[model samples]
Target: MTTRRTFMKGLAGGLAFCSCGMLDAASAQHHAPRRLPVMVSGKRIRTVDVHAHCLFHESLELMGDAVARILPPTKGQQEHFIVVENRLRSMDAMGIDMQVLSINPYWYGKDRDLSAKIVQINNEKLAELCASHPDRFAAFASLSLHHPDLAVQELEDAIKKKGLKGAAIGANVGGVDFANPKFHPVLAKAEELGATLFIHPYRLGELASRFKGNGWLANVVGNPLDTTIALQKLIFEGVLDKFPKLKVLSAHGGGYLPSYAPRSDHACFVSPQNCDPTIQLKKKPTEYLNQLYFDSLVFTPEALRHLVAQVGASQIMLGTDQPIPWEEHPVDHVFATESLNDSQKAAILGKNAAHLLDLKFS
Candidate 1:
């Protein structure tokens, strides 16, 4: 089988050969780094990013000056959020054919009416962006999941009325983890709707003291650590067992869980008395690892390889925590990973996400 990386290298060679005879120096340079079209099994392979973000500018404007004051922009935040042109350029340069844009929930604390407005505005703007640039973007809905009832309605509106892909939720809302039985209705609704539930981490509030000095470990270590714990809670608490078909995508490479799942499997076996007997699950902890989808944002090829080994190729998708410089060259990252074959590379780069999002390309 012609692997995706080999096929791309072959395509690049052909492009170089043709450009050498036909184009001038500047023209060749202009097209030099542009990604050549890739095909696998007679279908064009696109690079669909599962972990990209955009700030809700219109929603913020609706929130007015007071809320904006507290949520002041970070460096390059304006261009990253408000400026679509720059975003497109960056995508093209990185060979990302489409981005699944999501905005982290910041309205969890707002009043019901105000929070509803925020969800409405965010969904509408996201729908508009996807409509305007069909090829470049699709978005996950921003829901006030803290209010499960409202979140159910908001999710329905986003998918049914606004045509969103799904909802982006924080791992925990006001310190309430998803494993809590109270959140089951929302999870059931998502499964009923067949919507992909993306779980991103909120700020690690528990580590405020440790992260006070510098280095932003709160975001670095805290983000994945929080996600790991949240996912484990869901698994051990039998949330996965309850909603077997739930298509959950965990950000930050499943936040150290997949890589360290053996520990979990051992915990139950090594010390059955130490484990919770009431929270019985159908399978071992490691068995649920492959049931979830993860992004390739671990920053190194070895880490990605380990994740794939643990979770399988079809469960891993291309995710560049874009505009944040976490995993900048997403396509390059997948292609350069020697551990993966062409089919695995193709699946991670786009096929898995295309199936997950139900994206059809001509």
Candidate 2:
């Protein structure tokens, strides 16, 4: 019989796990073992993609003409979210048994009424999709950060009423960094409810001029930089202190922060006058990474290895940025990380996400 230890090892460097999720170890032996992926005792390993994206075409109506310029047209690739079978096929191909769906905020710049309606529709659809395929799909609810009080209710409703896994938010609302005290109620509710906040970056805003000409530098450099700035604001301005237990997961492997965090440990010291003494941080800047979470979207095994070294393997989870192909061979990427042993690989693959999101295998 395959023990949990050996099965997880198989997941890392050998065979893949179930295409259809397997049950808990305590009950797996009662049923026949599925050959597609390995099982421990009776439980099969799970592969979850936490950085997948989706959009409700109907919601775009609210954007009116602005979408043509503001949004990338959605027609290029046939979407997996529209066809459940297609998503399952894609997931099976990538060795991702499940994907946690999210829609990056397009409503951030819109007025309150418009943003609220758009968010309502997006959250309802996200919950609907997850409800349709509980095993193969889950989602983070969309929020309207334009109104923090409203966002608080949206988050509560999403988790408690709709059963979404968490809330997906942009790194900043337009250009307003989340560290501003205005957004605290939402953070407080998330901490109280133990909801994971998935931070995807967008809108380089003032930096747009510098990124004007290039090989998609707008996204290539902007996304990660936006995320890094957002995180730094929270850390430097003491937002993390106010809500120490916030379950924040940063996309794009936590942007550039994990790669260059220790430098922040020195910023306050090198320029002591620059940092506000009134806002005292509980830990060194780099140390806060231990309290945060990231994805495995960083490209190379070496990059992945470095991220693990900087923020421990437990802080990283599998992310594909799926439907966009930022990571086409995600499963292989994790298995190829020479620095990670089976347990660390297993944790990064699905265990960390399962624990962070409180995923219940069915």
Candidate 3:
């Protein structure tokens, strides 16, 4: 009979709240801060971050003179160059027990041979790093997605041999959308292998000019929009129907889709001409969300609650676009969601990720 409010009130004067120890976010910012573990209803919980970004130094070498083309070894890209112990400490402070490392694909435009070599090297480096700290890290394999045939083999080798969890993909490969049938073979392979494809949003490219002024809209607006377009293409073009079991998880709460997904449900009804009469979708546009998984990187309790409202909590998992510093306190972010019960909080923290990725931890 105990309500969630009183249950939270029963804990540490109702100030420590839901066990993430956020008691005072303001003061904690200035202080050394707490390295407390995440707990729900007095029980400790494991936290798995499915969206932490990383790039290997050796992989950068493949670019040679063109290394600066995409990432440029910026201060952000240099984060992993430090000792791994430092990263572990950062994870400890943030209450993350495990992170699934991923590298954003930059060689999507590179030639097939060069791109394949880059993927092979990066996947090896990722596997080595995960091998070093199996308890603290797992990784998604890098793939030469630009070439569908090579990607099929790369994914198999990375998962079957290298022991990676899955693969990280940009919203689009070069300018091509996932809906393009050319990539169907890779999607089919992923479904057959049950490999989760983590879709991290990337730059908007051609759309950058409009997002010019302040606020980094180029990223803030563009990245999520990129993901929205990618997901929509899969849904509207019948790609999801072709490969219903394809495991896809999108970063930043699957972009703006969840926010305005219902709007899409009415699109085919509102504008009959544009809705393709030849290809009928099996499910309502919004219903497609039920099959998709998303990272909890929306950045606010209310926002997360809304996302969960749209797509059940079972479809959400913890993520921090780490090293870039998008959501530093992801544990606190989960604990702060008033609408979630302790069970749901624990699931979002790590249980769901473990189930989805087949991860194991003591």
Candidate 1 per-residue lDDT, tens place, 253-349, comes to: 9997987888897787888898788888999889898889999998777888999999999999989776566655677767667899989999998
lDDT of 3 by residue, 60-144 (tens): 6677655545553233444644358778877888889999999888788889999998998999988988888998899999888
Q: Tell me the spans in candidate 1 whose CA falls farther than 4 Å from its real position.
A: 1-43, 62-75
Best by lDDT: 3
Candidate with more favorable, higher TM-score: 1 or 2: 2
Model 1 lDDT at residue 34: 37
Q: Which pairs in model 1 have colliding backbones?
A: 3-342, 4-342
Error of 1 at 282 (Å): 0.5
Q: What is the C-alpha RMSD of each candidate to the true structure, in Å?
A: 10.7, 11.2, 11.0
* Model 2 stretches astray by more than 4 angstroms: 1-43, 70-81
Model 1 misses residue 38 by how many Å? 4.5
Q: Distance (Å) between predicted and true CA of 215, model 1?
A: 1.5
Candidate 2's TM-score:
0.87
Candidate 1 vs candidate 3: which has greater TM-score? 3
Using Cα atoms with residue i matched to residue i, what is each candidate's TM-score against the true structure?
0.86, 0.87, 0.89
